[model samples]
Target: MSVATLHYIHDPLCGWCYAAQPLVSAMQAQLGDRLALRLHGGGLFGEPRRVDAALAQHIVHSDERIAQLSGQPFGEAYKQGLLADEGTVLYSLPPIAAVLAAESLDAAKAYPMLAAIQNAHYQRGLRVVEPQVLTELAEEIGLDGTHFAQALARADGHTLFEHVQASRRLLDEAGGHGFPTLLLEVDGRRTLLPHHHYYGRPDAFVQMLAGQLPAVH
Candidate 1:
């Protein structure tokens, strides 16, 4: 089978990344074995910050805009439950670390684990920055909890720093500004797929990206 790789460079905490989730899923399903997708985490909040009253409000506003534009879900739990809190600082490392861990242990689990993080954060009103929370989420998705816990705990500074560096390298190499960037790679060549259409019509988006895939005999 002829196959190509799709490089997804994104921050797990990014609103736009969450918005693009469904589209990416649809693309993978349509492409089947014709596509190989890799997930990369960009450290958007390398230096974490507490979601203060003002910042929380701003996050809600920005996420709302993303939801409207992309037709993605921004539940009341996220807007009212999570964002209403002032004590929680938003950090990107824990979730990124968890994703990398999943990728290492079982590559197939990586994207599912990421979707779990986004769902936990936006739909379930869960604070995903805590290692324990990530462990529980991974376990809930049928991943080995012990392995996940170890991975979560052992994600030392260097490990996380390397991931952040790698994320930045992919972004710079792709000439992308930031998160939720998708690149289609075939035979060592790369092309950036315009992510706008993926937000609305994923089937059409996949068709545009894959370009008239062969029919089943």
Candidate 2:
């Protein structure tokens, strides 16, 4: 049997990534240890940037479309609070570092940490760029807050920068043009899988990948 790895290229603040959370969950449940699921943060907002009115409008419009197509909820708090706030920042590095920190402590906690961060931004209207917020999210997912914070601190400087760069390289190598790209690697060869059609339908996503997966025995 050949080794299989699924690379998920995404950004913490990307609305489509939030929408694809369910598909990720389905993949985990169905594939289990037979396939290695790796997350790559694409650093959509590598530099710290505040959300301007125009950007907020664009994000709201894009989020609405994502919710409509993927059936993911954009909470009232997000819509009425975050988007409406003029002082909101859209930095991705802090949240990405938080995910990396969780992965360092426990590989299984990585995805859950990402999910929690996404929920913090898209559902709870929390400031994911804040260190306290990221730490709190980690604790919510069962990680010891102090350890998580320390791990986050360790990943803060050069480590997080390197990870983001690596993820971007993977995106380029995989021929992915945007966030939420799924690249499946069997043995050594790689193929980019379709993600749009599978939105709001994780069962279909699993079924499609089922064919590409090699027999276990």
Candidate 3:
């Protein structure tokens, strides 16, 4: 059987990526070990930036649309707390590095780490850019404290920069249009899947992927 790889291009800070979590989970359950799920952090907020009142309001409006379409919850902590906090810095690399750190220690935990980071950000209004926060999230996801600390320390530096660069290159090669781009690769050919069509309908998403899997002979 030919290997089928699904490349997910996303950023932790992206509300849409969080909205796509259900679809990702459905794909995981449907494909199991039959397919490989690869996550790429495209670094939407690669630089350290602050969200002003106006920008925060804009984000809230966008988030409401996402919640309406995808059925993903946006906690009050996020809408009222994090967004309202003027001094809070937004950067994607730190959380992306946390994911890389988890992946380095255990591949299975990578997605879980990403999920946890999203939860902490959207649900709990935590400052994910802080190393301490990232470490706590890692431990919460069952990763060993000592090893994860070392891995995160290493990843927070040049490793994360290199990974983001490579991820962006992949996006450019795929002709992707921003975060949450899903590319299905069967054999050596890659086809970009129209994932937005099934935002809240994960079953439909899995069925579509199932129809394509037979070609991987």
Superpose all Cα atoms of candidate 3 onto the true structure and report the RMSD in Å to 1 decimal. 1.5
Q: Which rank order by lDDT, best down to worst?
A: 2, 3, 1
Please give each candidate's TM-score.
0.93, 0.97, 0.96
Tens digits of per-residue lDDT for model 1, 73-107: 87788888888878777898889999988887888
Residue lDDT tens for model 2, 90-133? 99999999999999999999999999999989999999999999
* Candidate 1 pairs with clashing backbones: none
lDDT of 3: 0.90
Find the candidate with the highest TM-score and give its number: 2
Alpha-carbon RMSD, each predicted model: 1.9, 1.3, 1.5
Arrange candidates by TM-score, descending: 2, 3, 1
Clashes of 2: 0
Off by over 4 Å in 3: 215-217
lDDT score at residue 193, model 2, on the 0-100 scale: 92
Backbone clash pairs for candidate 2 read none
